[model samples]
Target: MTANKIIFYPDNKEINVDQGTGILEAAIMAGVHINSPCGGKGVCGKCKVRIKQGRVETKTVGLLTKDEIDNGFVLACGSISLTDVEIDIPTSSSISREQILTQEAKVEHMEGIISRLDAGDSEGKEVFIHTPLVRKLHLTIPLPSLDDHTSDLERVYREINKLTGLEDISTKLSTIRLIPEILRDNNWQVTAIIGDGKLLSLEAGNTSHRNFGLAIDVGTTTVVVSLIDLNTGMIIDTEASYNRQAHYGADVITRIIFSRNKQGLDKLHQLIIETINDLILALINGHQIQQNDITAVTCAGNTTMLHLLLSITPSHIRLEPYIPVVNGMPLINADETGIKINPHGLVACLPHVASFVGADITSGVLASGMYQSDEVSMLIDIGTNGEIVIGNKDWLVCCASSAGPAFEGGGIKAGIRAMEGAIQRVEIDPMDYTVRYNTISEVKPIGVCGSGLIDTLTEMLRARIIDQSGNINESIPSKRIRETENGLEFVLVWKEDSGTLLDIVITQSDISNLIFSKGAIYTACVVLAGKIGFDINDIERIYIAGGFGNYLNIEKSIMIGLLPDIDRDRYKFIGNSSLTGARFCLLSDKAMKIAEEIASKMTYIELSADVSYMYEYTGALFLPHTDMGRFPSVQL
Candidate 1:
């Protein structure tokens, strides 16, 4: 195959690829990101690019309109370049980092946890202990004499033992070689960097106050990093961005399939590392901190994400008997994992519960303090995979359901992620069937996001524009309700009101997809509760974790059967608990221990093996539920 030159406009990036290569692959090589939720299988029409001057062969148009095809628009994943090409990627098809939710939600309960630690109460102080994963201790060595001469290593260990009251301590040969010079040059004064029962480095003078660490949340869609002052247990700065590995897939299962390709696992691993490193660079640069000062990093993510972060093969996770490579990871050196921090810095990950229910849920359980409570509670993290945990200090159970990417804007027409031009709220007038909506960043609407989709479904139900089965009411007297070649569709935004200058409609098929997604989540929660001899209503409190939960409307979510129809007051949102838990672990070793306990104590229930799952899932496919008695609050 001969190489052909390809140029992408606006970005002005160029790359050469073998002839007949997919345009999507060329864009990836050229450092351009085009949204492909279907992972280049050509099912999603999102990877649209306009050909300015090129010879290309498109295998299938898929979702592209005839008008779009006539205008030289082609699906980047489906098109193959026969000769040199010049393609332009539209803003609607490009991924942006401006709106990735990096900040955790503000909740009184979460603040109370921090306040208790800050106040230094007896129990709180003892539990947290301010024992960071890495610590810098300033020590003064006794001056050596002819009568009491000892090796520099022994002298240093003797002082450390006396200070920490610990008998066992260790160090590397590299640090041992520098002890004589580091001790004598500083006049018997040094700051020792210790972690995991070993000395990492020794610095001259009192450098204890400069110690820093990172708390990382390696989410499937986004990556967040928080730089913290390990000495004082304070966050210095935070940064986040979209995971660049999304070029391969939108969800873990798809990524696992992609991993079977040649060098696919390595490519995914490198992409995630690049994303984290970029965020690390931004955080350190903004705070004027040195890379070497970051003595440790604590991470929280799903099983597949953690596996990919450490470059481990996760092929078995999606297969039968679905077992992960390691549910509980051991402490590793930062350099070994290619994380850009101190070379001797330690890296730690929160433990996982099962193949699908992973550290993110364990971290959530820890951050929510549910495992320590006497009353039963439920924790839910909604994404492509919906993880549910229910328990108290006495018992715990968890399950994960493959809810698909409908909530994150996949497999739906006119759907997108939570970005700057996305519609995130919707309302409809029951009298005239008119629609009102709000876009993120106050920009013109491009597409509906998860929250907005939920709002739309609820509003449609309330206004009777859609039936209980999510069927569009074509009999309604409104222009917004019309039939397309695909199916009956409801226009949320007219072409004139849209940033893309195209009508954004929610089709009947999109409604069914969302119903299936919501049904899977709701059914999983119910089944998990049933396995423990409980009901959904028996959960005294429900803690919602994740970025999606931060903006989600409880009323709308319940109305759509995505959540149980419990009392609204029983619901509490603990945003980004995974990151919060990582931060806690970075600041206190006790927190890390508790997180491991949470992972170990959890009893995982595999839903696939349960006979009642499909039967119960069928009942949840309708609005609210097929059994109206389950949703007493929803009167419609």
Candidate 2:
């Protein structure tokens, strides 16, 4: 096998790969980020790059234009290095880390929960004690004499029992071997790390104050890791980045399909592990914390993500019956899963309700306090899949809709992730059909993101550039609204004003994709509520979770029918509730228990099996709905 050197321009980074390696694979090896929403299968033309120098063999040009092909543009996923190659990764195809979504909303509520747990207040109910998944206790064992000498391990266990009131603690033989040396060298005083009824490790002297844990949210698109101080339940720092498993696929179904290929599961698992390890390393290094001091990690993610994280086969998850390997995962050592934390540190994943209704939803339910609410509340997490949960203190029901990745910038003509320079907001004047837009970080516009797409659809509808059926109204007569070879498109930004120096337009096809995405989400909410014989408007509150949900304009979302049309006050944004729930479980044993109970109590309604789902989904395909009576608030 011949190894060829590939150089990526602008960054000037280079790597050596086998001669037949795909340009996308070579870039991955070089630690370069490229947008491949279809996971380097050449189905999506997002991995475009210019052949700056040397020979390359391309299997397909994909969506590249004739001019682009003439100018050396080829899909990186489809091109392989025939010789030493120099590739120019375009700005539009590069992934940016500057604006990754990490900030969470509803901080005061989380703070209140923490305060209540710390004060042991349950409002006349069972108190959720502040027992973190991992705890460190400093103990001074009385010196062992022959007259009353218990075995060294038993002596340590006795002291632990006295301190923690836990009688049946267990530990590994390796930890038992270290007890004698650790206890004697520290003059009979040592700190014991206990996690999930087991002694994880023993350290000399008082290391109790240095205890830390990680709360992780592994989304299909992004991975967030938060370092927390176990003693105080304070979040030290958080770091987030695009999930590298995205190199394989954009959604769980695609990844699940890929996992059936040779070593595909291993590859996906390794990519996610690497992504998590990198984030964990960033958090630990930034805070000057030792890896050993971080004793536990609590993870919350969709079922597929959790499966990939634990190296479990997820093929069954997307099969006919849609069964998962396990909805309730057992606690295991972090090293067993290749997470780069303390070797003996424990890892716990929040429970899942079903194949699609995963731990992320359970975590959201816990974080929203919807399960304990007296009034009915709804929780919707908008991503590649739209997960909806509706119920109150007495009951809960959930269903997942395959909303696709249109919201996350997949399957759109001029779409990208919500990163710096991506257009995130838009407005159009009805008088002249002129457009106004705001990019993330106020930088030069590169492309449109989920929120920007939603805003664009709403503004276009308001400006009458597009009708309710998501068809472009060409008769409006504006230079921005022009017919291209692909179809009619409405330009949001001219090439001169764009960061990529390309006109960013929303095509008729993009409009249709957005409509389908919104329809799926809206229909899921309606169907789930209707399943329980309740109207969507009957819910007292709607809590929106996930990073994409955080930036959503409630008015625009309802206008486009992505969200249900209800009282504006009923909507509340609880950003990244999955991560929040993971943090709660990490900090409170009672929260973890509650998460499990929520998973078990909730009933999963499979929408695909429902006979009325298609009927309701078809009705929702139009702006708001074909049934105008359902969207009285959207009087367009």
Candidate 3:
């Protein structure tokens, strides 16, 4: 056996390794996480290392070019050292920080989540920090004498320019009109909140102390806010509450319909912004943070949320040709945008790729880190709108699916988010048919979360509780199976334990929606694979990305054909990839460039417009798919 020293260039640290081990294997053995988007399968080619000196074996490369191979840029997962050598690892956030990739299976939620799945949190009280996506700052400028005769506006720009070194500043007519009066009133000492380098708001004088910004993610049923320190980009406080838009409807289509009515759009917009401002106040008081300190904001939501947030009409987007008033918009001042962010702050929204696939997909694409590679890769943001991205450096193809809120515990009688009291994951006794579970708070069960929903669906299917066609199998001997006003359901919780127990059964209607939703996503996966002639097996690594992805069971997900049938080892659940990506974008300009590049290179495949999609979707209605041979491991 040849002797080898596995050298890590991070902090210039080095470790010795046996000759046969690959760099990734050795790195894992050494506890170094060198950003592998493909879970170190060599398909993504992201884990590239420069071999200063070494010889090694390779696994396989579906992406690396001849020039790259010749230049000694090797895929870490595929290469095994045949001799002693040095490798230079790049600086990746995954390597430099305390990376939390998986959402602990059971995290504490406030309500509507833990009890149904019978879960309990062991992670302890979440240590929260307020980190506004944007911050507003006030600066005091000294009055100019005869020696400094520069124009007031020019003089103001000088102060900010000298302070931040940002040139080519831009602002609205509203802010520009008030500049002179504000400058003189504060004796040239003023506060200004900048958004994407543009001056958003300005006040009387030096009011810089209370800087703050709000980072928001708008879901169909919920909205989350993180109040932050804009200067330091630290999240000082966070508050999440259900999206009041639920009253309009549970999903985007309903909300879009709501947007079409006269005052419906205005009401929807007002309610959300009001909710944002309310959360901002609570967070500011909760953490003793200054609201005026917030100067800028960044929001990640579906297209509908962005449209509603902007008070733009979104009904046309639901129709054919699927055009939006604006797919992506530039930065606007907080006052104009009506966000809870500091009035002086700027509100910067993420770019949207399409109507169905919006900023959330862009955020997920950035978060997945697939854009930084030259290999073939895929990023799937599973939510009400299931956005799928397939490509690497050479090409990218995208498609959107209506996966629905079922994955997030919606539509079901007792379903919730991955918050304080939700039951997240579950396992059932095949014989006795009893249940054991984990929840968010480690408290008594109340309702189910996303993971529990998938677990229940999969378990019910395997136990023959539900059939291939998603039919409730009432013919079983269990008393828990019964009919209701809403149709069939299996009794999960007794009446005493739950608020209502008509037996929280998976209904025929619910099954149809679930199947249709899951089928759309599954169909897109197959169609994209067919478009490139790559089988699901060809995907060496499968990243189930997003907040929901972290808690989803791959086995069950595959068994139900929500995802492809691959080795459990091939899948990596990346929790909150969108937020992580947005955070990175906020933190580093380099990360922002990467996001733009990802958006530009990605080719969107229109499912509604595609002719073959209907056929593919129809074929995917059965459990584990209508084509059983596609699923090799399923015993049922």
Candidate 4:
């Protein structure tokens, strides 16, 4: 009945587990994060641990070579402790908060974003003036007299009507309670934050200059927030962090499944709110601003994320029919949604196209200006769930594919988000098989990121280290490409050269996962185009939208078949278009209207229902693609 002591090195942290408990389970119970991208299914072969001095039984030593098995290496998930043991948890198996893609990447594009919204173009020449969704109107009222004694609330409403030219405006009970005091104390002078016939708040004095709004991009893995000066349509500050819900699950479907348990939905909801408020608090404290100064917020996320944010039931989003509770949500107050902004501040949840293709994609289309462009264009959001929109001003078609989290460092061994010390770029010398990698901030590589993964795949293919089938070529004469116990892996950085003090490698399994992910994305694009009676080349321009695209090399992306083999000029890396679109809606009601219109105009194509989709996906599973003719530029 005694517990087996499992000592993990070199940290020497010890956790006692029951005799039959797996090493991965013990690690989890010990508050350790091991790379189990397949959710510990024992298929990824990522959680390999060296049993230094342990008596354990392994059901299956997956992907390990004879030497590795002899050296006492076994899959953590496949091994169960039988006696007291000491194990070495390799650096490749640990998940740390060292390097995650957050706010740093957005800073470089802030001015460009501001200029685009201000000038309507990248050149910053012609200014596009527009009204924000939330407007602060200063009002003055005459003292109550016998001749005209109108109620304080009625007087304010009358003035608001005169200013906004609208009838049937609504005010919250919280705003109503403070109306008399605010009017009387300020001598009948006030500023009102009004949007879409809703009086979000009424201030005692003229606080119009201090009015602000938040534009948010609620990504599955990360969340970005932008604080804007609503008065001048300028972004004051921006913040980002990892989504707190990621602890529950990495992707939306996993989250949806996790939310089905008792109190699961509430926990997920609270986590996202906490994540957002943390960012808000950072912005407020850092910039010396008050939460009340923020009058409104607009959030852009997938339907599930949007649902989870509002605590809406997302069980059906994963089940048959895949219908969401609501696609277009009405404006709700911050207090009601538990956002720490002004109690009366409106939280305007943007309209979504469908269950999978939510407001993020819709807002992205609007932000990219593709909704109004006459020429054919496409927007591909590369992430855990890859969403694609292909169309122009006249019409639009969209689809969502399960690309897994390989690109965002979810499933790969030694994979990390785009942060400092993460390898963001990779190049291989064909002659010597020497590998050169660049980290995000020129630090030692802890893991390879999405861009670096693509670069590695392309470079490896070009160097003949891996064939089109994504299998490592053992026949190739290269020390870097060696057959490991867990299959062949190309070592990018040695233990001495890496930040983790463990070799950074991409295994054959990692290559397969990457291939499947990139294949899903590329196939989704091709299938969407084919359904439109157009080839992949027929699209005039392909706009790659995401923060991840900021580090993407168009040639390398195409070389890996993540993107289509089209003219490089036609590829536009519009960084964080979802956030950009949300900001557009935050600053301009017209843009908000356009976002709704884009959502309405888009035709969501469910790939699961399409027969041709599976075929295209199978064909795209190879390097570049099964159809070599499509990728003419790919020499391999």
Candidate 5:
């Protein structure tokens, strides 16, 4: 096949691709970040590029205004080059991996044991003491003598066995080299940081008080790291950042396709490591602690993320049967994984149940305590993918639905990840149709996030600005509801009021995407519940988990049919349950065992194989739902 040379402006990056190649694909291959929130499906219209001196064949230009089409503006994902051409990619159209949502401010809502203990509640204080996966032991040994002379490594191992009363532990060669010096430098008095089967480090002096571990929630859209003091199991601080892998694609499916190439896996692996390293640097610097003081890391994420972190190919994850390399991963050395922590530190990944349902769900199940409850309980983890777990102590069943990235603020015009300047809430006046909203930290609006999108959609439905089908009412007598280049859009913030120069608006297409996302979530819940011979109302409690769940409004979530119409009292919002589960496993051996049990015991139901799931999804495509009886509380 003949190749064509395409030159990108501003950065002046050039790449050669086969004839008829989409510009967005070329940008991806050339290591360029183009913001295509729909993953190059040609629906988002976010990857707008201007042609400088070339002609291209466009499959669809509906996203662009007539003026824009005349002015050489086109959607990169929708355009194919007819010849060698030059194009200008705008900064607004570039994907910013740094914009990931990472604030732990909302973690106060977490219902885990750690949060209760940190609050100093009497019930928690009476129940148990903090126990971490890594234990620190202080040891004093006699100086080298004929009768008592023992190798430094063996001496340390002996002391560890005496303290923990366990045999057959593995030691890293790196720890062996440090044992001789760390033991002798402190006059044979040293602290051994150890886990169940691995020796992390041997530090000089009685450094038992300095032991620490990190609990990470590695979401497809964001990465959250929590620094926990091992001695007390208290979260000292947290750091969150956008996942750098987002530059390749917003969802795991896109990344799975990207990994099919030879260097793609390595590139993704490096990006995630950099993201983790960046968070590690921030936590250490913020706390004024040395990197060596950190002993272990517990990571909770989906199956694909675990594969990418381990530099394993995830191509098969999206294939037939959707089988992954392994649902449960073994302990990996920090150095082997390129994690910027103690060289001998252990990085443990929580086990996953299936390809779609992963460690994050297992962690959420563990954190929610739904597994131990006698009454029926359900968990909904809403993110790029929606994972639903339904059951109680007796039995558990789960399923995953491709909810897309709409809820994470992808696939929408003027949409951004949950960040400081992103709008978190919304209220629309019924009479005037004027919009009122609040941004994170009271910052000027840059874009609307997931919560804000739900609120807006609900309010629009109530105010009659949008119908049950999610179509904008063009006849509405309001300035906020007006037609735009991308069909009819409701303007939330004018150019003067927004942080950016452009007007922040929600389009009809954005509403459609969100509806599809919500429909998938609700359908998954119904399908999982039906599989267990139960109705949605049979759920005694509904636990919402994830970063988006932190700020989620129950009323609005139900109003949009994203959640079931159960009594408000039955709904519980547990912020970042995945991270909470990771922390629980990090601090409690029992919690880790429970996590494994959850992964093994939970039944994974493939929704694609279920014939009824399609009917449920189509029914949920309307505002609230096609069956008004399912959502009695929702009034429109």
Candidate 6:
């Protein structure tokens, strides 16, 4: 095979490759990331490097115009080095490793016993305290006779309204027709189960023995629930399951686009509702509790997700300006939202600030104590969306970008949820290219989850299988290198060693999508922080919030520049902050006020409007970044 000596100039690193090896691949052999917004398909000509001294034979130039060619700029992926050549690789063309989302290095949960005692102390050290949400009750009343002169329905309505603060109660026609029979049979002593600002069921006499409430965090990829004992203001149980909406589309935007088709909205609605109801059934059945006992609910989710849950049309959100029908939705009944709780139970969704910065961020801010902190801090809820809250006591700012479902195992080929067989972490030998991976249960790996993906990206860089610029070296001696239809691929595992007989690898396309996903998040954080007249490092603490953060590897994440290279001690992890925040609000009215303030004070930055975002994104598409100064700890 004819070899070409491609000396990446300035750095002066030289590598010899066969005729077909890409210039981007040659650059990686020297350690660098070329910017490719369109995944190096030559569609985005951003990955231009100057061929300073050699004949470079070229094939296609999808985005390169005549002006670019005249300036000696060649798309690294499009043109091939024809001979020994010196190339001045511009720093602007480099891609850096993005900060991966991780669980906080430190856990900051309330002291279980202390929190319990504080909750009880205010109410005379009593075990029971009143939550703001209303409850259901069945009352027995005195019978009205002909001499008393009050109509049966009027008497019942007047007494019930006076006792419960509800107005002339409503019921189904069947219930209303049977009202006289029930009053006569029970001698005016009957039970009423209040739901959705109205009466749901009527029985005979006092029955408040089993009151339940459900607080759920509806993630684009997963749904979690915490069952609350409304009678005692205590969390009784929790349940989690995959969101059924994955079948439609992996990300919110994709799902929204899918929802525009015929019956897509209805299917999307039923899928999530079914997931929620299954969890409720799990909690109820596990404790031998009745479904009728659940008289109230609280839900927290991103704006697009909220729209889906409410069955609201989400087509407009995917369009320009990204407008949504409502941010802070009004409270409704369980029946209205298809929740299988008590029929008339109130389903209160946390209020949202904007289309991007929804209640999930508000709930996360509440849980992270962002509104109460005196020291400057950053709260990042790394989920399907990158919801960031930066502030302390004086001021607050928020922004959310669609990070795509890459982290949650959506876009990648061998991706799966962090389930039993999912790979959670990876460590690769630099000298030998051997690999060691940890699974969710240390079993045979099925697919790589978010944590595993972070570890893999870092390991690949450190091991030299890929350069800092995220390009694979097809010239490496290891059999892991293979020619795929998409491009060159590096196998993480061979088919014979696997559980499902599949060769697991990260493709060039995967790397491209990941770059954009993490780049968008990192650049958004940087841009938003810059707009606030401060840098990300100026904050005293960085709070990583969300379900993904609970199990991610912080060190590996930092090594990849997916997270800022700060003192590990400065980061704190709060698991499922959205749910925790809702729980706090459920336990104390004070939390609601705090949540409201966090939402009100937050200055949301729309990154889409800022053209500089792409510029920042271009700089971040490297191993640790073009400006290695930012990540002092990440060294080659």
| Candidate maximizing TM-score | 2
Per-residue lDDT of candidate 6, residues 1-636 (tens digit)? 899888886667888888777887687566544544334456444466777898887776544445447767788877887777788765334432111111121222221312542454332322313544645566666666678877766677776787878885776765577678887787677767665456665666555767777878887766777788766666777777656675444467668877896598898898789878987898899898888878788888888888888898878887877788887666686778999987766787787777778888899887666676688888878887688778887898888866776776655656555655678888898888888887765667767878888888889888888887889887889888777656887788776776434567788777776766777677777887888888878878888888778776788777766777888888888778878766665554456656777777778888877887778878888876788998898778
User: Which is better, 2 or 6, measured by lDDT?
Assistant: 2
| Candidate 2, 1-636: lDDT as tens digits | 998999998779999999999999899899898888898878778888999999999988758766578878899999899999999988778864444732332232243445546665453423467789999999898998879868888988999999889989899999988988888889999999899898988999999999999899999998888888889887777788788888877889899999986499899999999888888888788889998989999999999999999989999987778899999998988879899888888999999999999999999999888998889999999877789999988999999988988998899988888877889889899999888999877889988989999999999999888888989999987999999788899989988898866678899999999999899888889888899999988999999988888789999999988888899999988888899899889988889999999999999999988988899989889987898888897878
User: How would you encode candidate 4's per-residue C-alpha lDDT over 1-636 as one tens digit per residue?
Assistant: 768999887667889888989898887677565655554567666677889996999977655656457778888888999999899866555544333424343552354556666556853322335677778899997778898889878888889889778788888787899888888999889998887777877988898888888999888877888888888887887778777676555678878988886598998899789889988998899888999989889999999999999999899988888899999998787788988888777788789988899999998898788877788998999867799999988999999988888998876876777777789888899889898888877877878888889999999999988899999998877778788656788899987898755678899988999999999999899899898899889899898888787778998888888889988999888788888888888887777777888898899998878999888889898988888898999887
Q: Residues 219-300, candidate 5: write the lDDT tens digits.
A: 7878888888888877887777767787667889889898887699999898898888888998899898899888889999
Runs of candidate 3 with Cα error greater than 4 angstroms are: 1-148, 167-210, 416-422, 442-447, 471-475, 483-488, 496-502, 588-594
**Candidates 2 and 6 compared by TM-score, better number:** 2
Measured on C-alpha atoms, candidate 4 has an lDDT of: 0.82
Predicted structure 6, TM vs. truth:
0.75
Per-prediction CA RMSD (Å) = 2.5, 2.4, 23.6, 4.5, 4.8, 14.9
Runs off by more than 4 Å, candidate 1: 1-5, 16-19, 52-55, 82-86, 101-116, 120-127
How much does candidate 1 score in TM-score? 0.95
Q: Give the better candidate number (5 or 6) by lDDT.
A: 5
RMSD of 5: 4.8
Instruction: Please report, in order, the local distance difference test score of every candidate based on alpha carbons.
Output: 0.87, 0.87, 0.66, 0.82, 0.83, 0.72
Ranking by TM-score: 2, 1, 4, 5, 6, 3
Q: What is the lDDT of residue 435 in candidate 2?
A: 86
TM-score of 4: 0.87
> lDDT tens string, model 1, 1-636?
788999998688999999999999999888888898788888877788899988999987868866578778899999999999999886668875555642232231233334435665433323466889998889899988998888888888898888887567898898998988989999999998999988888989898888999988898887878888888877776777788899988889888888866499999999999999988888888788999889999999999999999999989999988999999999998889999998988999999999899898999998888988888999999866789999999889999987888888888888888887889999999998789999888889988888999999999999999999999999999999998778899989888888876788899999999999999999999999999899899999999988778889999999999999999999999888888889889988899999998899999999978999999999999998999999999989
**Ten consecutive residues with minimal summed lDDT in candidate 5?**
120-129
Instruction: Itemize residue pairs with steric clashes in candidate 4.
Output: 64-485, 65-485, 132-587
Candidate scoring better on TM-score of 3 and 6: 6
Error of 3 at 440 (Å): 4.0
